[model samples]
Target: MFIRTESFSQYIRQYPVVSTLIALNVVIYLLSLLPFIGDPIRNFGVGSNYMIAQGEYWRLVTPMFLHAGIMHLLFNMFSLFIFGPELEKVAGKARFLTVYFLAGIFGDIATFFVYDSSYLHVGASGAIFGIFGAFGALVYYTKKMLPQLRQIILPIIVLSVVMTFIGPNINAAAHIAGLVVGFLIGLSIFHPKRIISWRKPKLKVVQKR
Candidate 1:
């Protein structure tokens, strides 16, 4: 389906939250590359499979901002550029941000279970995928309104699934986890009754002639 929302920059002007997130991810990635920048940034990454054992709960949130490399950052940022704005338009700034962090943390939680905590897991892909998941959720409940998107939904999902297989460090577990949580959040937020009521249909009664 065609993109019905405003352009990304226009959306940014209206809803600056998504722009801030993308900017943060880019800034962190650039910082990670700087030689003088040391373990302070490195410590933000999901370090060595360790859980809350030492009370490092911030790992849940910090990993979403850290990236393995420039390529990783770019891929995730591109995904956000494409999908984040529309979700923000539909869900509003607060809910949109909620979807991002909830999905990201859930994705990281999935990583904790799937990968070694000792393994360094980093990147915004988890959050990006969560946005994709939010899109999928909208496609589910709003199909009547977004019928055009119904046709493109499959191809979009296929592409994402294919991308997950591309690299050894892709962190599909986190991506898939983000998708699931985002989908559920979408369902909760865009439930058919609430959204349908939002568009409140007017039934006109015609007298029998």
Candidate 2:
């Protein structure tokens, strides 16, 4: 009982990291909406092959927090809300950030190489997709949750992929890149027992007379 209780507490504690990520993205989105900021901010976002070729490497990282518009922002934030906290709980704060950005940046890298010179993209979806992939990994790694994951997350993933292909202006490469990177990270990083407890054998108290 005590172990379970402690596990729950640790899980709850991980939420603030995810919340901070959401807050940063929201704040950046709000900043992007300012009168003069829009144009300048777009420069920070992922762009066509030419833009990256011109030494705008920062675009790889910045696009993770950039959203095109309010609807885009809301949709991505909703995804973050759904996936971030749970992932943070499992991955812990540092690994969660690593998974998020590593996948997101790799998504940008993929877009850089795969798409046409005119293609441009922004939004948290790539990173969020990474989170989704992590969730999928978590589901698979956790034996008890396999049934629930198959019933829930699997369908959502498939639907999301279908929607991405059909959706206008979607960066399919970014989505695919993030998903792949995230899954690999999950495979390497996720370990259930560490989160639960690292129990050390209590020394047997031999009362030496």
Candidate 3:
């Protein structure tokens, strides 16, 4: 299910929401690379506890699209690209957007409350973790029916949580918060019944009586 076999055009067509999000991230990242406007864009968009406290509320949402560097952009966008389409397929466009943005905003909100006023962070790791959490919820709801999903999803969650704590300069608070929010949203909204088998049904020929 995680494997993407779609062509570039097909991918864009099939997963428009994911494609738009990836495009937005890339466009914002490119804008941030500009010598003149780059620093300004980052300064304005980055999630800053001080600025947030000072009433710059949009920072929460903006940082979802902002990135500190090309690597940061690539990593987050890649994560979105890989995991997003499936969720989008399951959740539909609206719920998927709700999950993505809410998870990200809540992550920023968590960071705001957890860190001191001097704290500054930029990246979509929180949102990406949110996607992971949504997958976790899928695994949870479908465990009895889809036992194989545990093997596929559990390790990714475990490894991601481990890396979150051990990795330098990582924002554990946002990641954890986003994950929780995503999982909760998933549990509340996602029905196990919505999950359908990806394999094509085989047709059988009946012998004439």
| Worst window of 10 by summed lDDT in candidate 2 | 1-10
CA displacement after TM-score superposition, residue 147 of candidate 3 (Å): 1.9
Q: Name model 3 segments beyond 4 Å from true.
A: 192-209
Error of 2 at 44 (Å): 3.3
Write down the worst ten-residue block by lDDT for model 3.
191-200
- Each candidate structure's TM-score, on Cα atoms with residue i matched to residue i, is 0.84, 0.82, 0.90
Q: Give the TM-score of candidate 2.
A: 0.82
Q: Relative to the true structure, how large is the alpha-carbon lDDT of every model?
A: 0.79, 0.78, 0.89
Q: Model 3 reaches what TM-score against the true structure?
A: 0.90
Alpha-carbon shift of residue 84 in model 2 (angstroms): 1.0
Best by TM-score: 3
* Clashes (candidate 2): 0
For residues 22-84, write the lDDT of model 1, one tens digit per residue: 898888777877787746687656533575446787887888888777777787887787777
Residue-by-residue lDDT tens digits, candidate 2, 33-150? 7888867877767455777888878877888888888899899987787667767765778889999999898989999999877778888788988987877777677748567665
lDDT of 3 by residue, 1-209 (tens): 88899999999999999999999999988988899998998888989999999999999999989887777788889889999999999888988888899999999999999999999998888888888888899888888887777788889889989999999998999999999998998886665444443344778999999
Clashes of 1: 4
